[model samples]
Target: MEITIEDLPGHTKASLSGRFDTTGAIAIELPFNTLANERRALVIDLSNVTFMSSYGIRVLLRGGKIAMSKGAKLVIFCPDTAVSKVLTRAGTSDLIPVYPTLSAATAAVS
Candidate 1:
């Protein structure tokens, strides 16, 4: 996976691309942790993520927990249909609201 993080006022947005499998999940751990520590809210843009595995879901859940513990929120935006299915089936969508648009995702935490 490739991650590009942008810091916005009161929140951060990370744009991710490629397959979000075990390797991809591993690659993002540190950056996610950093963002969780620094921001009041996070928005993960997954529009370019072609696939998502259980490991990927774990990464998101872990990050979300960390953010919550720090009094922050984590949201995901624009995941592909396949990735959305995995998140929904895993029940992660309920835990961390998934938005179909950037505006909606940003608004949720704003």
Candidate 2:
């Protein structure tokens, strides 16, 4: 997976590309957690993510917990239908908010 981070007005945006399977989760776990730990507001862009697995859900849940513990916010935006279904079915969409747009995601975290 490819992860690109950008600093926005009131939040940090992390754009993820490639499959969010086990390998992808491992590839991004550390850095993603680091951002969750450090940033007060983190908005993840899932527009480019092609697939997701249980491992990906784990990473997101962990990140969300880490951010919450730090009194921070972490949200995802622009997940395509496939990815969105995975998240929804896994019940992660309830724990971590998912927005339809970057602006909505950023505004939520802000």
Candidate 3:
């Protein structure tokens, strides 16, 4: 997996590409958590993520909780169908909002 972070006007965007399985989740966990720790508003771009596993969901849930505890928010955008289903099934989508477009995600965070 590859993680790219960009600073937007009112929030930070982190784009994840490749599979979001166990290995991928491990690879990104630290940086994702770091962003949650530091950023007030975080937008996660998952359009390029092709696959997601339970571990990936765990990572996202952890990040969301961390952000919330810090009085921050984390949202996901552009998730493909497979990833979207995984998130929904895992109930992660209920805790963290998922948007169909980047604009919508950024707006929610903003």
Candidate 4:
């Protein structure tokens, strides 16, 4: 997977692309962790993501736990493709809260 980090006004958004599996999840975890420290709410954009595995959802849940502990939120946007469906099938959507778009995710977090 390819992750592009963006420093938003009061949040950090990570735009993810490609497949996110156990192997790719390892590489992406570091960047995701670094971005988590940026703001109270961490936004993950999955619009460009093509696929995701349960391992991917596990990575996300870890970050989500960290954010929650810090009184921060982890919001996911563009859960339209297979990536998002994987999360949904993994039962992470209720745990992390998935939104339709970036704006909606940001707005909900704000």
Q: Tens-digit lDDT track for model 3 on 3-101?
A: 999998899999999999999999999999999999999999999999999899999999999999999989999645988988888888889999989
Specify the highest-lDDT model's number. Answer: 3
lDDT of 4 by residue, 34-84 (tens): 666546878898888777887888888888888888888889996577667
| lDDT for position 61 in model 1 | 89
Q: Which candidate, 1 or 3, has the higher lDDT? A: 3
Q: What TM-score fits each model?
A: 0.93, 0.96, 0.96, 0.90
The residue ranges of model 3 lying beyond 4 angstroms of the native Cα positions read none
lDDT per residue (tens digit) for residues 3-104 in model 2: 999987888999999999999999999999999999999999999999999999999999999999999999999645899999988899999999988778
On lDDT, the stronger of 2 and 3 is 3
> Candidate 1, residues 42-79: lDDT per residue as tens digits?
89999999989988998888888998999888899974
- lDDT values of the candidates? 0.88, 0.92, 0.93, 0.82
Better of 3 and 4 by TM-score: 3
Model 4 alpha-carbon drift over 4 Å, by segment = none
Candidate 4: clashing pairs of residues: none
Evaluation by TM-score, superior candidate among 1 and 2: 2
- Model 2 residue 2 CA deviation in Å: 0.9
Local lDDT at 105 for model 3: 96
